[model samples]
Target chain A: MTHGTTSPHPAEPAPAPRRGRPRDAARDRALLDATLAVLAENGYGGLTTAAVAARAGVSTATLYRRWSSKEELVIAAAALHGESSYEQPGTGTLEGDLRVVLREKAAAMTGEPGRLIRALIGEAAHNTALAEALVTAFLQPLYDRVAEVVRRAVERGEIPPLDGVELLGEVVVGPVMTHFLLTPRLPEDVDQATARETADRLLPFALRAVGGTP
Target chain B: MTHGTTSPHPAEPAPAPRRGRPRDAARDRALLDATLAVLAENGYGGLTTAAVAARAGVSTATLYRRWSSKEELVIAAAALHGESSYEQPGTGTLEGDLRVVLREKAAAMTGEPGRLIRALIGEAAHNTALAEALVTAFLQPLYDRVAEVVRRAVERGEIPPLDGVELLGEVVVGPVMTHFLLTPRLPEDVDQATARETADRLLPFALRAVGGTP
Candidate 1:
């Protein structure tokens, strides 16, 4: 799991400590949790290193000592927050499984994890390292899981062996991402109802894209 | 010509200036052009109203006099920059015209306008008014143009008169937008070759989605 370009998290601590001993694993977890907490309450623009330190019960110097910049800190927090146990549902049919997977992904976007993800995406535009980390750690796994299902459908001859099946996620998840970013709806309002509606509407096109009769 | 929630551009000037007689149309154009220039050099994170005003040869107060906030200024700038003379290509085939239009849209993403567009997208994730403006001004026009091509295709019996042909842009343009934002490629490197390749790959899927044989 790529925590980020930097290794300041408990899961992957920095190799050499800048202090007397290696950074405390528990402290790293607290700091990351605090980072996410702050992100959840106040979007990226409101997140500050001092605020995070105060929330985590650590000094500002500790945070600066651990992470080089706020961008690095945010990316680390994003990766930590993004860790999920999303299992690919094997529903026999491509559309059925896609609806399940997409619904789950969409549901996740309604919570703190989703907000942080959006914040990270916004920040990533200006910050290259964060952008790369987001692609590698956050987006790539989700894409890989979606790609696996499409690969299986192709192997079963359920759909045509499309050349760009790998990009299925772009079509599958793009509209929801667009809606999340551009829509002025409250996050709670984008619940299972909205997710289901979008899934029902877009799944046919996704299935058809792979040459499956929707 | 939808200039956003707060229209300060000449195309759609503010309702009435907060002070003084109506704002100068030429100043609006200069500020918007300067906004794009600043955005091209520094992504959204670095964009500030002061920099934009300085670049446009105006005082920060002049900008504040017209627009309520920086978010409004950026969106108006984005809308002004996004104004294009792209006519719907009538190649008589859905795939052919889609390829033409998609290629044109993709090519635009390789320049300064594209950079500002991406910056606005990132910023929109947080700014509600900007988000609304983006969907209304930037995306809605582009979507309308693409939807027209699909409408024509349906009329000609080229594809099933499927509902939501209006959303063909989401499926068609989604992949390219995803690629443009997430990929860490230098703007100059995203040339005609990359644009053509994306257009070719996605056009097939887009056609299939609309029930047209690729």
Candidate 2:
């Protein structure tokens, strides 16, 4: 949601509601959807309130009334995506648990949700505080999930738990992103097919690197 | 080297040595050193070719002799970081390998070379071709080393290798870079002293994910 080159804190929590007819949740949704659409079609530099208002079929005043700026709207649009609770799979094996998690993310990444996110991350670079907000809103949950799983594995004694599950997350994620970022060959190796393949060749190195044995 | 936005393939490789003083190799080194110094002191957007040339004590023409554009200069600065060699420890154990690599990178990251590289990646979104060049020069060696190790492990039957060594590289590198990119903290688990502790936790999941340990 890091949409602009400015400070990132959300502006005053919607100001506790102005005296208006119950804000149309539908219009809000419409505006967000339109934002995602337009973000994909055009990079962050091109996203405009006029285009979003027109596309959402709402008035400019309606758009402005809710969101103070494009950055706020971008954050809201990003935050609106995927409110699913992380399910801890009690499959007794780490592989099974991670498989379910990675696959779910893969699907989500392949959709409009992922595209909007990519756009946000791209823009965030030129904007620091905004990038922070985007990271908090979009990517933090994924880290939390991976961290919890490693913790659960340690508690279960399925593996000799390390001090940080977060490290495990890094080893798994770093190269995939590096390759994806560098080349256009494959976007993210996030699916069952890629994940399965990753599990086979990389897991050993990662396992040993972390000191867990299969 | 995220030369984002748009790119045209390299402008036909620097047309072979046309007589002018053989392109002062010493001057090239000084300019690169200047580039890193400027990056560390001023950060990315604030960097310029004139500043670099001035710092290096070379004329602007000397600077232009090496790099055609600022993006080109920045990307080259990142590439010429001098951490080119990859060494595999013959500690006869997987944990040993992980320790050497992670510790070295983390330490390197604390210095100018690593910091400058990170800054370049941050700038990747603004320039496309620079990103491409940086990836080719820097991250590729990392990918190659890990991939080679996986190939050896499979051949030795140290672990049953499955598939996708490249993807595995991502899994390993992603979190490390992600943390460095966004936050100051990394998993202490991968610290030089505690690498084995981290490796044990990471191994089984990594191995299983890669398709080994059947």
Candidate 3:
């Protein structure tokens, strides 16, 4: 009952070991790497900051310092996560360019991307800020790359005009994505034969939709 | 709750109100209606059985009576929701039959169906059971319907056969669904012009994908 006597064991022993908030670029990279690791191991909902920090051997504050929320962190991690870097060949033909571009990202096509992409999209559906960030950061770049190929096709007169670029975008990615989003069972790798078949089949519809070919 | 307090709930003064038991037809219909209302108001994630019960003027027990989990109930509500009633005219041609059927449904489409349809698909993304139930109950039916139409088209020598029936299903719904899922602004109507245009534009590709036009 001695009011003045402080406990021998102070609250949070060692004052939680303050590190003075120095920017750890190495820790940040590790955290991002760990985020992808956790994402691949578990889905978007299952991935946690604690797990990422633990995996990266960094304090949780280090993570919070870089990312405002889990969603932002996940998107950033996704951007740097894997073989997202693509090389679309400047083939003389439209189909040639598509085949090259798609085939480049083909092997790196893991199941994780599809699920995370859908989850990110679903999250964006409800969040305006996230949606804008997502479009500007993740989706826009992908769209721009695809649109460039399509534009090249127009220049080569291999396909139609730009009337249905959005629709054309959908036609190219719609089945793959819809299948990915709704059904995760399909294999992601599109081999040459399959890619050629798909191009032959889909390019026609896209052509007509964009007021070309037919 | 307080050491076996006597049951003095005014809501259940006499016979205990049935909440966890099997719900009858009338109760089931009411719950489904309430579910649609809740879904319309609160969206997929915000929708709860409590809201459904409150909206239906039924006890929580009664709400849980027919459905074991909220996921199941939502799926059940959406599963039994569609009207498959149709007058398929044997107009001596596959195109005629498809055009007639789709045109009619398009003509009769309302905002209610569209919203619920979007909500159901949206919810399915997050909830596994909802996803299975939706594909099983809602999407499967649509798939089967379109499959039958394609099968008839083959029989009538309208198109060449393709391997992916599900792919065919996607073609039927994909373009419109693209707008539905991606665009925030919904048109006032499904719009007869849009429907006709979509059906016509997608027809040649659909025919080619299914089988070369018979």
Candidate 4:
């Protein structure tokens, strides 16, 4: 819920008396959507608060009231985008849960969401704030979900207790990340068949890596 | 090696007659090094041919004589940087060889090379040409090396034949790449001890994934 480290404009007037919570929510969503659109079109370097505000059909002052900086706006947009794309799998078995998770993740890594993420990652390389925000907003939640799956399996005696459970996140999703990011094809060209096959193929390795039977 | 798709400036003069082969080699190295430096300092968007030329103390025409565009210059520089950093492992055992390779790659992912790569990946998200060049220059060679190691292991009866061997690259090195890139740490601040520890922890999973005993 924290917008970012920087504070919004203190002098900006409060919302109009007629402006309700639902309208405010709608405005926030519109701004975040505009942010993603801008990121997808221009990448991180080209992103600016002015451009986002203009795209959202809002004044710069309004945008500043919501986000103190472009980086914070990006972080917020990415978080909202990721939540919509990611599904928490509750499938009975570990393998089934992983398959659902991986497939969903691969699907997310294509099209506009993928492009926005790449732009963010590119910025995250040198921008500590963005990097940390990415880890916090995206990676940590994904890791926690994976850890929960592992925890369930351990309780069911499906596998031995893992010593370094944190590493499981990388072991499980790293290949998919590599395939999506390193492959030369445009994200839109990443067909579902390829993602499904990749998920099936790597499932064994993932299971083995986590001390589960394939 | 092919520089890139775009040919050098058609009207540009050839190298001076006094320029010996060694000096030409030295000049190429300097230009590539400067490209890396510029990329490290200013990500992909900020990198310019004039900046690289000025950094290398060469005319823009001289740089153009070698690389036709900023993208091509980046590709050439990245190819050279990857070549010098990558070492083919010849350790007798597969585990030992993988450990060596993983450790070396993790080491390379720290510092200037890492920053430059992050910039390139950022650019690659939107630029098809850069993406293909990255795969050819970096990922392909690494995959080939990993395949060779697997081939050796198969020949020695260390493991059964691996189908879709291409995926091995992602399987073995993907975790390390994820750890380095997504960990939110400044590349320079990535200590050797941490790299070594990550290699050690992921080694068993790598072995298991590759169908070898840990």
Using TM-score as the measure, the top candidate is 4
Model 2 chain A worst lDDT window (10 residues)? A1-10
Residues A1-98 of candidate 1 have per-residue lDDT tens digits of 44433444556655675564565667777898898888878877788999999999999998887887877788777767655535667998888888
lDDT of 4 by residue, A82-191 (tens): 66645578888889988877877787777656767776776787788888989987888788888898889899888888777878889888988888877788767767
* lDDT of model 1, residue B7: 46
Query: Per-model TM-score of chain A alone?
Result: 0.76, 0.71, 0.66, 0.86
Per-prediction DockQ: 0.44, 0.24, 0.15, 0.56
User: Over the stretch A10-36, how does candidate 3's per-residue lDDT look in tens digits?
Assistant: 222332223533334455567878998
In order of appearance, the predictions have TM-scores of 0.80, 0.69, 0.65, 0.86
Ranking of candidates on lDDT, top first: 4, 1, 2, 3
Per-residue C-alpha lDDT of model 1 across residues B122-195, encoded as one tens digit per residue: 77767667777677666777778778888898889888777656556676666667666665554446777877
Candidate 3 local lDDT, residue B51: 90
Candidate ranking (TM-score, best to worst): 4, 1, 2, 3
Worst 10 residues of 1 chain B by lDDT: B1-10
Candidate 1: regions farther than 4 A off: A1-28, A45-54, A58-73, A186-188, B1-27, B38-72, B164-166, B186-189
lDDT by residue for model 4 (B8-105), tens = 32234335434333355567778988988888777777889999999999999988977788888898888776655456788889999889878878
User: Deviation in angstroms for B210 in model 1?
Assistant: 1.8
Look at candidate 1 and tell me the lDDT of residue B49: 94
In model 3, residue pairs whose N, Cα or C atoms come closer than 3 Å (at least 3 residues apart or on different chains), thus clashing, are B19-B61, B19-B62, B157-B214, B158-B213, B158-B214, B159-B211, B159-B214, B160-B210, B160-B211, B160-B212
Per-model RMSD to reference: 5.2, 8.0, 13.1, 5.9
True contacts kept of each: 0.50, 0.34, 0.13, 0.63
Q: Name model 4 segments beyond 4 Å from true.
A: A1-22, B1-22
Candidate 4 chain B minimal-lDDT segment of 10 residues:
B1-10
Cα lDDT, model 2, residue A63: 91
